[model samples]
Target: MVGVMDDNRLYAIGEVARRTGLSVSAIRFYSDEGVVPPVEVTAGGHRLYDVHAIARLEFVSTLRELDAGLEDIRRLLAGGLTLTELATAHLSRLDDQVRRIRSRQAVLRTIARQHTEAEQVVLLHKLAGMSDEDRDRLMDDFWSEISEGLQVSPDFLGLMRNGPLVLPDEPSAEQLEAWIELADLLRNADFRREVREALRETFSGPGAAMMTSSKMVAAFERGGVIMGRAQEAQRAGTPADSPLGREIADAYTAYLGEIAETPDSPAFREKLAADVLDIERLHLESLEEYKTSTDPYTRYQSLVAIIDGSARQAAEFMPFAWLSAALKASVSP
Candidate 1:
């Protein structure tokens, strides 16, 4: 029952508690904290709240149940804050928490699968938290280092530089694992050296001079056309020593000569045939490394494929094989 003094009605602490479902002690504490101060106090120091104060206490109790801080409730009660602002802040906090939780899940999954050390776990956490820009920058630095003083084809170098693991807003365990492995591989000094040497031996050596020439762009375009013809011939199962095969081979050799800035000759054909054979050997060795050796470049490629959905079928080497045979058959017996 409301107490009456001078024809004004007010609620005692116990009465407000009973109505609002807050404890008498909680109402008293809220009053003490000025979050819901009482409207009156008697000579006996008993607290009493008016209808407006009791309503304020009810609202404060509701806010408390919703996890609002006392200071925030104070501001809200004092009309210095709006519900929209509070909701936005809480939503932002929830989004951050969700991201952190997902990252933790990914890291734990990685750790469980790998049975890594504590330091490794720490590193995993850092990797999971990396921003997209930071991730791209890390890969960019890696590509820059490996491509330094190296005349890599623009299209090929662009592929290397542009390939970055795009972690989802909530990354899956597998995605995160792939990203971690790829990042570690990219940062590896030995892996960098391995790639640099391999690129030089495989790509930079055979066509290095042609790529450096002023007409290299035109040469590459012309080579593409020549290679396209060779690929078509191979696809049709044309015999390497057939007239059509020889005709395409003549054009292919001519394009190579133009790129090499030399005339087509018997000596050039023989040397190039042997050089192409050596290239095949190098390619086989590299493939074997991917299959059997501890070298992680293959792992790097696989991880990138996972991240970017570029994990298509393996490159068809039949074209190279056909071209090699055609090059050999074009030589005078």
Candidate 2:
């Protein structure tokens, strides 16, 4: 409590409250907490504040509003911590709080939408609680296992072995779901073995294993141009049997020749067309298995891309879809 005061520089607690717009009790609590002690005390035991003390009260109010614990504030006032350190600590705390809240929201939405089983509900909560470092480490280990001892271009492997997945601070339900799916995929031996075997077969061509990294990159870039044309033709609804389609097919045949170290001839074209159909059949089989839905791997990468704001270039197998059509047309009657 504070009564009338006569000093021009010193103010009663009431005036300090009026000047700072803080409640009388709040200032008292701050004083009692030793965060902002009054400059003087009256004979009647009232607290008195000079301008400097009032300024400190205002600063204390701001810190309290930011959820700074009293001990931290006291240490800050005692010169044990700098303002920059305090702000940085609080900022990191806020980031963690926001992440947790957003994770809870995502978990709730996923559970409600999916009617997730108790077993999975437990797992989802565990995943939501994981720090970014733990999540990244888990992803790193999975990719390491997938690419281990593979006879493929390191550059090619690097593309699929995407770097850290930085889930946005405020993750969406979809992103969480994708993360969970990725975690599950990593745990599934069948998925791991299949992905490895596919990579093995794709890179097992006679000349593919023999090409230097630079040659592999050069071949990949040249193929990119052909796939770009394939995408354009596909987008324009060009008939597969059109001359334009055959031209694109011929270009792809040459690109394959470069990779296979085989000369472009009808025999090679026939072999290429047969090889293309084999891949096309595999894709068709996948579509049948999933009823034309996005494959789990593709869906996971796409969702992760949205979260991290990084582009996940469409998988190589995807562009090859258009090329498969052209190859079929080139070989048909």
Candidate 3:
């Protein structure tokens, strides 16, 4: 309608029909449905399109392929549904569909292994879901049983209990899988007993009380960073035995000394040294069962050597060597 009369570029309904394969009546119905608006009408009152209608028809065809209802398509075209908001909603629905499909695939995979139908069904159920509360309770029970027999101060036990595996109420498939694995781990009596034994030793030692816990944590944090640097310097050929390690050891010992009521007592430092070494030895021996003769680097063995050989030398010499000293300080007037 806005075109120059002499210009022959304007398309009539028949041309649009040929171009888009949509009947004139169908196009008219779409315009009425608000799927697309006409460009204009001619003076003779005939409907005219200026190349835009073909594009609109193609868009409508694609929407129809996607099973979008006509009214929904109309709202989309009318700007009632924003592209971002609409795409996000569809994507969330698609994700759920994908999760269900993957769960079925896992069941099929297990069935391929000649599992019984009941077993397959159980596996699917295990894979499919978990509630947040179930995850929390699983961790709570594990940590509680581990800490129950330990004389570990109340604060340390509380801290361990708080590190629960938090899962969403509507978790993704990956999260569900992790939850199942974690729950299975919690059910293992060997693992539970291992944790209990470890906590018992750590709690029975000199740093069992709240203040000692705080100081040890601070020392570990401070010492760990220094330990990393010291090892790096030694690895760089700085010294056969870098004083960096010794310095950190000294700093850790000095920190314990400052807080220790018996900083100057040689007997206390020597006792603390023996205690630290004994704890490391116990940690190593307990894990020896899992180590292969061929693999010299078990986790516990490596950790003990690293801490014992390096900064832990001073760690062994912590000035606050006696729990009785710490207790007396706590009750002092």
Task: Identify the candidate with maximal lDDT.
Answer: 2
TM-score of 2: 0.57
> Candidate 3 on 91-208: residue-level lDDT in tens?
6767777766765554455445545467446745563454557756666777777767666555545544434455443444444443443454466787677657765666676635
N/CA/C clash count, model 2: 0
CA displacement after TM-score superposition, residue 168 of candidate 1 (Å): 5.3
Cα-lDDT of candidate 1: 0.73
Sort the predicted structures by lDDT, highest score first. 2, 1, 3
Q: Alpha-carbon error at 242 in model 1, in Å?
A: 44
How many pairs of residues collide in model 3? 0
User: Which ten residues in a row are the worst by lDDT in model 1?
Assistant: 309-318
Give the Cα error of residue 264 in candidate 3, in Å. Answer: 18
TM-score winner: 2
Q: Which is the winner by lDDT between candidate 1 and candidate 2?
A: 2
TM-scores, all candidates, are: 0.52, 0.57, 0.45
In model 3, the clashing pairs are none
Error (Å) of candidate 1 at residue 166 is 5.5
Task: Point out the higher-scoring one by TM-score: 1 or 2.
Answer: 2
